[model samples]
Target: MRTCMTVRHGAERRTLMMTGAKLVLMRHGQSLGNEANLFTGWNDLDLSANGHEEARRAGRLMRHHGFLFDAAHSSMLKRTIHTLHHCLDELDQSWLPEYRSWRLNERHYGALQGLNKDDTIARYGREQVQQWRRSFDVTPPAVKPDSPHHPGNDPRYASIPRCDLPCAESLAMTMKRVLPYWQDMLLPALRQGQSLLVITHGTVMRALIGHLDGLSPEETQTLEIPTGTPLVYEIDKAGAVHRIGYLLPPT
Candidate 1:
């Protein structure tokens, strides 16, 4: 096995390369909700101005490192979609096939959507809010059917079966939906040696990374994926992870 480490500005970074196949997973840039410190959940919001620059920077870094993809994937949400667009445009590969799926959407925060995070922490107590945010299976309080934040009431999900629409979701539940898309869509492409780029939300990326890296539920909770950072995974022909790390130096 070969690995390279570099130090710049007092920070150490690791770069890993695979012999044949690669997978890149990136969390979308900061959203307006993120800027407001609100629980966005399934609410569709655009990226903030800083978020757009972040996406562009991520793209430039990837391109400078010669990262290329045969296809790209993102959630149906506008934030992720815009991030993908900006990244691809920066890479000058906007022609790549782009796949969008609801399975890649952020974890539904139920009635917590649109609420300020600090206020929620104050109202529900910090420990409970943390559990709702990080626990694998501890679902938050479900949004009422009439609640504006309820995904079941969103017209964008109209084509999906009503039973499949989530009013609230735990990380584990989000993984259940994400894995099928990986298995049905991404895995086969990888088997054929196609490099893939996936732009998604933080929790969704965590679910996928945990699944790919064989992490336990507890370990997944401790994992933090920063916005706009690209995680690179090198997989061998046997479908095992050969190496994994961030594509750019940590900011």
Candidate 2:
């Protein structure tokens, strides 16, 4: 089941058809746990059937908006890659080239990867879960070094420093991993007027947006950017601040 998406402030603003390319931050389709309300960080779960449909729907939504991504990027995770693939396919640009970087991945939840969000809420209490999910700092207890769940054994992360592997991350800590993409990859494209589409996790996106918008810790806590929504952005050459930030139709 897809969670209801909310595009809070875009409705009041008008979109510009400037010649410069902008970034489209897309949340990946509904995952199995997304329907069930679980924490999916770094678990590498496959997309559920309805999750695939959300990807298809996102593809249609992008095409309908008259936006074409020059190239795309996804997390190494399949949910994001598949979402991007599905969207590109619907755009009839499945053959278009793309890139993948771990910087765009969801915030790692360590030992919490396979846990149920609701049940965790029950055990930890709603406020604690909220803090874990929304709090900028305060990382949850990490997976033990010896646990099989530890990401150190994960082949995909073989190149990453073993010390950083299989650890927990707060939403604030997540930005440290995610922001580099903007610095190293995405920012240059925006400067060159190249349209880009990025499929990433919700908390990661929130961290990115939180950083960009200079959101307060309290404000970050209240912001509920939904999954599977299309966020269209326009930033200046320096990649400094949002010139025009809002969502598109069906927002």
Candidate 3:
């Protein structure tokens, strides 16, 4: 049976289904870094041509499924921001309120930012690289504070505390930053019964999914999150969040 519930958006009120608040999580489409097989981290690269198409297709898929959102959130990175815009455009929801934060960014890769992944594997043994890439607590080497790859060098992060800036991060470290945003912002909004769209990076999305689904570190490491796919979840009244399915096949 279908039920309806009232949700508030600032001063505006919206009536939505009581099935539970729907939350959609998506990773940005292929970025230049991805196409070049580079360790992107938080380098803030733009999407490639194929990525643009992927974004549009993801949007169309959601629209075909009759998905609508009250608000959206994304990382401060342009790739995610652009993908969100493309998806919103296709859904005819360009006016939706958007919130962006650094906490939603990809794991900081430190000195690996522009290096080709294969080359890195060659320099560091495959097993070592794998550990850095897949281990829950093994962080990549830290970049020097003066390095161009460091977050401290970016003007966008000037307001952030100097101590909070990361030179490199493990999945565990990324989760530490991501969980706060979920607990402080997303969870409350979900409880308020507002449907939300979150466009973020692969590692950040994995961190979130790990928390929501209570996946172990090993399990999360093995999980592959495809880019440009919408992962839908329904939050019950008791505050449990579980996946419904992806809007597309998740290829």
TM-score of each: 0.92, 0.88, 0.91
Order the candidates by TM-score, highest first: 1, 3, 2
Query: In model 3, what is the error at residue 22, expressed in angstroms?
Result: 0.7
- The residue pairs that clash in candidate 3, if any, are none
Error of 2 at 89 (Å): 0.2
Q: Give the deviation of candidate 3 from the true structure as CA RMSD.
A: 6.7
Ranking by lDDT: 3, 1, 2
lDDT (Cα, tens digit) per residue for candidate 3, span 51-170:
998999989877766777889999999999999999999999999999999999999998888899999999999999998888999999999999988998899999999899899999
Model 3, TM vs. native: 0.91
Alpha-carbon lDDT of model 2: 0.76
Worst 10 residues of 1 by lDDT: 1-10
Q: Using alpha carbons, what is the TM-score of model 2?
A: 0.88
For each candidate in turn, give its C-alpha RMSD to the true structure in angstroms.
3.1, 4.6, 6.7
Lowest lDDT sum, 10 consecutive residues, model 2, at 1-10
The C-alpha lDDT values of all candidates are 0.85, 0.76, 0.87
lDDT of 1 by residue, 47-160 (tens): 999999999988987777777788999999999999999999989999999999999999999988889999999999999999999999999999998887877677888899
